[model samples]
Target chain A: MTTRSPLRIEPTTPPDESPPMRPSDPLPALPPPKPDPATVPDPVISARSLCVWYGSSMALKNVDIDIPRHKITALIGPSGCGKSTLLRCFNRMNDLIPGARMEGTIKFEGIELADPSIDAVALRRRVGMVFQKPNPFPKSIYQNVAWGARINGYKGDMDELVEKSLRRAALWEEVRGKLHKSGLDLSGGQQQRLCIARTLAVEPEIILMDEPCSALDPIATAKVEDLMDELKEDYTIVIVTHNMQQARRTSDMTACLMLDEAAVQGGHRTGVIAEFSPTEKLFTNPSDPRTEAYITGRIG
Target chain B: MNLPVPSGSVERPRWPAPSRFRRYQGPVMLSLLAICALVTVLTTIGIVAVLGLETIHFFRESHVSLPAFVFGTEVDPPKFGIFPLIWGTVMVAAGASLIALPIGLLSALYLSEYAPRRVRAVLKPALELLAGIPTIVYGFLALVLVTPLLKACFEPLGLKVDSYNALSACVVVGVMIIPMVSSLSEDVLSAVPRSLREAAYGLGATKFEVSTRIVLPAGLSGVAASFILAISRAVGETMAVVLAAGRMPNVTANPLRSVETMTAYIVAITGGDASYGTPKYLSLFAVGMTLFVMTLGLNILSGLILRRFREVYN
Candidate 1:
């Protein structure tokens, strides 16, 4: 009955919520304070001064972040703000994109990922990924979970491995009777869990998920969020999400990224980390004005 | 008035009334397109009618018997057994598949999974150019070039290689249909969702593994359909076999010997003078009918394969 233009910015500040911060305010020179060492786990993968580019356009600039061991770290931001790009950089997935180049160092368990001698295949075995959309191979349910282990030369009992992976993904109970059926025959939520099971079968220490629940219904999203909570006891996770509430509900650490308007050149704004802090503090008391604007839904 | 009337009370006139021509345009265009579609169907029916009538006339002749024409091996008084012709066709087609299937599949995999964009842009059209060349030119090439090369290479090994042989025809025909298999298979392989490839890559699979294990299996139905279609092309091919494999209708498996295929025999009979309603003229219809049945069967099989194994992605 009525048309509400998306571009119309009505800055409504609810009485209980903090006031909307203006974009003109200067950002802090230093990054947000890190959590106390006694309270947080040690860093497993660290990126310092990481910069990525697609041809002449800079996608990510001077990104510095540490992924703590056995904890869920969420990267939340607007579209084209390099959330997916940064997540892809963790496992060297960016190498697949033509003309995508990165400058700077990324260390995964004391090994420099960018070093020419480091085999991407071996690195990927230790760090698997689940995509934004569920992408189970056009295979049977059992084979979808076993294919990775088979290729990686796993000598263990395959039936046990498949069951273990499925159970870990919280999908074994639903799919136990139909392991021979086509993976595509599963519901959307079941398919996403199958993808997670497939990643788990590789025995990876860390899992990178790129908006894993964006294509799922609320029930599926909640299921995946719960699975992440359970998985963090053993596997470190770094998830990129457009849903800020999902980040708050599932993550221990949170990072907000936004386009650097001051650094805009030729109509392209490079992505930079606006704030990085504990999930609770980042939500309750954001240091950056842009982070507050994004968190309060006043601006993206 | 104390109260304002509701919006439903307003009766605004249209700026321009809908035209009758606009309403009729869809049905008129549809009828024209239906006529265009019926042309191919009519042509197919016409061919079947002609072939059936002539074949019936051939079988009705007093000298001809179904068993003798299909199974007997007599040479005197000219027994019309089609075994040798059918055997020649099968041999040539099978040999061509040996050479073409692997080469075409590998090239399709390279173009779809490994070749850079600029390389594919330049290479794909060049590969398709193989199909655009006239079949007669390939016939000439098989007759002169490939036969001489095969003879020169095999004679040194103390093996006899005929000047007009089935081997040369098979090689050239195989090369001729390479574009058909590779192009169609490449289109299918490329149609597979990028997410599937990314999923495999994220699971620590190598590029070769991803191409062979994931993409290949996903596109297998289309690739097989392409293979069947290429085989049909080989079976129906005429000029190349006639040129390189001379008119000797012996049913032998040796690739070095000269062989006459069913298509080659039809071309030989039709190109020469054969009066209408004569057994010789009527024989052409029988062979043509057989060829039509083979190709139609293959086309149907290809369509069924495509329908049965096609993957749906959301």
Candidate 2:
């Protein structure tokens, strides 16, 4: 493993130019009636009373969360806590699961995400996803980066776009000379980054990563974490992870989900958000006893 | 750490020593299984030896030369030609492929990608049952029904349709192999990881694009292998071709004309009253050897296609 510094020193954007805020950033939305002061001034995705079920068993129950624009928000929890489910709900990826049902509203950029008339395909184009497993298509590296854009009717200099996407994912420096090699030939870390580049090629506004480094080694994990830090400058990111250290290292906001022990019904445990706050505050001064217990390893 | 220390007071569990019968069980079972495996290997060797010896004897006969047998155009008196038989087999195999490949592939795509769970459970086995129907029955059906149907459809358009023709044989043979192609291809397509589908769907690709562009291309090696295997099955198909396609070994491309495939020729000559040591009797082994080589080559080609192009999934 190449032990490069985890902290990236150079900025891809010009030094004179800061991260651009959208015109919609000025308004502090007031729909929830009782807004948490810790919540961001603007949110890219807001899920209200989101409940998800897989067939007869419930997975998530009345969980509310907000993912702010151009910020990295980490969802951390133990197994079956539904952190991954919540992240999937942002892009409606749960729709792919058979018998998966969801109730409640997921508003993506002021539009109802669950509306039947809202094309999921079009929604996915605006909000791309990176899976827990690196799933590079069985094609050349160039094709892996270019295919999504090609199918989505991208009309531009494809070679330039591939280069830009790869560069943005911090993978071009290693793969620039072998652009035509199979994407599967890359190492696990590179494959995951390649997946990130594939997601970026579509120019999505938000990127949902589901434990993007769980299958990677620690060194590779740090590389992906570094890539995530760089990516949050241009794209809103919501990542589901079990590694609490990773959440603190890479995210400004963190939401921890826990099994609702008191709400256990018919032998099934529902998942609810135990705490959602700034990463530093949640780790240091947790208000909820359950959150403190979980943070201190007394319970999960 | 205040861990419990062993006091050496508790008795350890003990297992009994193996009995005399138990000691011999391993070698006994090993030899039993080894013998069963050796049976199949010996059977294949036996077949090859028989075919080789007879083919060599046929070639050594006074009037029969290896080149003349393979490349000559006559089959009577002095000349022994196998080209016409090979041509007929090729024609049937190619024509059958034209029918089976697209239909089989589409059926596989539908089964793997579009069919509901309940529908697939019932449909998959039912589709495989098509392969269970005896080939003799297919031959009879082709001779009595398919030939008449084609004649009725095409004779009106002033096209000559032979009572026993390669067209009907091709149709029946093609239908016979649809299950083989569809079943094999569907297994391959289904083996494509769900993560890849999710990846495509995540990129806003429609289900159609996911199936055709991603899943199909990912399993291209297996799909190509299935096609070759099906074509080989069609090449070696005997009863249906013998009954539907007449025993006339003519080198022609016309589907409406009568033709005899290699398998059909072997069947015809073997059933006829030719003397045991005559060239005619020995010709059966020669034709049998050709058919064996053809199918062997195709099977090896299929295996090669699978190994050479298979996508490794981690």
Q: Tell me each candidate's TM-score.
A: 0.89, 0.89
Backbone clash pairs for candidate 1 read: none
Q: Put down candidate 1 lDDT per residue, B185-215, tens digits, no spaces.
A: 9999999899999999999999999999999
TM-score of 1: 0.89
Q: Stretches of candidate 2 above 4 Å error?
A: A1-35, B1-14, B17-37, B300-310
Candidate 1: residue A163 lDDT (0-100): 100
For model 1, the DockQ equals 0.56
Q: Where does candidate 1 stray beyond 4 Å? A: A1-41, B1-21, B62-67, B73-77, B299-314
lDDT of each: 0.85, 0.85
Q: Candidate 2 lDDT, tens digit per residue, B110-141?
A: 99999987998999899899999999999999
Per-prediction DockQ comes to 0.56, 0.55
